[model samples]
Target: MKVAMVASHYPLPSHREEFVARVHQVADAFRRTPGCLTADCWLSADGDAVVSTVHWESEAARDASLATVMTAGLDIGYDERESRPREILHLVAR
Candidate 1:
């Protein structure tokens, strides 16, 4: 079954644009990875938050891709830019 991963990020006021750009880059990289169906990034209207949603072929595939990406350091630098820890949610099609 397909799985969707949704992540919400709240960047520091000074890092909003940089964070959004980095998120877009991460989404593009995920889109090119095997088993990734689609990836998208959205910026909040107030410009302080960003959200990313990625769809994968399966939960196993998502986990594998996440591990690979982490090992490769292909991330948005959330630890440095975010005001706090990001939130990640997993979902499946209804």
Candidate 2:
């Protein structure tokens, strides 16, 4: 089954642009991965957070690519620069 991973990031005021740029980079990387269908980053409706949504061929593919990217130094250190921990959600098509 196809899967989607959604992540919400709340960066500190000073790091907002940097965080968004990093998320965009991550989205771009995901798009280049073998099993990714599509990936994009967006601002939250309230404009207080950045969100990244990535669709994958499967949950396994998403996990594999996540491991690959993290080890490849795509980690943006959200915990260090964000105002709070990031939020993540996994979804599947109905």
Candidate 3:
């Protein structure tokens, strides 16, 4: 089944630019992974939050890609820049 994952982060104002840059880089890399249908990054109008939406071919594919990315340490350190922990939501195509 197709899966969509949404991740949101609230980075410190001073770090928002760099955080967005890093997210773009990471999204680009993720888009290249197998089974990744699309990856997009968005910035909130208020300038304090960044959101990423990634669509994958399947749940297994998404899980595998995430495990690989995490093991490779390519998971950007949002914790370092964000005032609070990132939030994630996973949904299946109906």
Model 3 agreement with the true structure over 1-94: per-residue lDDT tens digits: 9999999999899988888888888788778789999999999888778999999999988988787666666647656668998899998998
List TM-score per model, in order.
0.87, 0.90, 0.90
Model 3, global lDDT: 0.85
The segments of candidate 1 whose C-alpha lies over 4 angstroms from its true place after superposition are: 75-77
lDDT of 1: 0.84
Which candidate tops lDDT? 2
Between candidates 1 and 2, name the one with more favorable TM-score.
2
**Highest TM-score model number:** 2
Model 1: pairs clashing at backbone N, Cα or C within 3 Å: none
lDDT of 2: 0.87
Q: Which is the better candidate, 1 or 2, if ranked by lDDT? A: 2
Give the Å error, residue 80, model 3: 3.7
* Per-residue lDDT value at 7 in model 1: 92
Candidate 2 lDDT over 1-94, as tens digits, reads 9999889999888988888899998988888888999999999878789999999999889898887777768866657688888899999988
The 0-to-1 C-alpha lDDT of every candidate, in the order given, reads: 0.84, 0.87, 0.85
Ranking by lDDT: 2, 3, 1
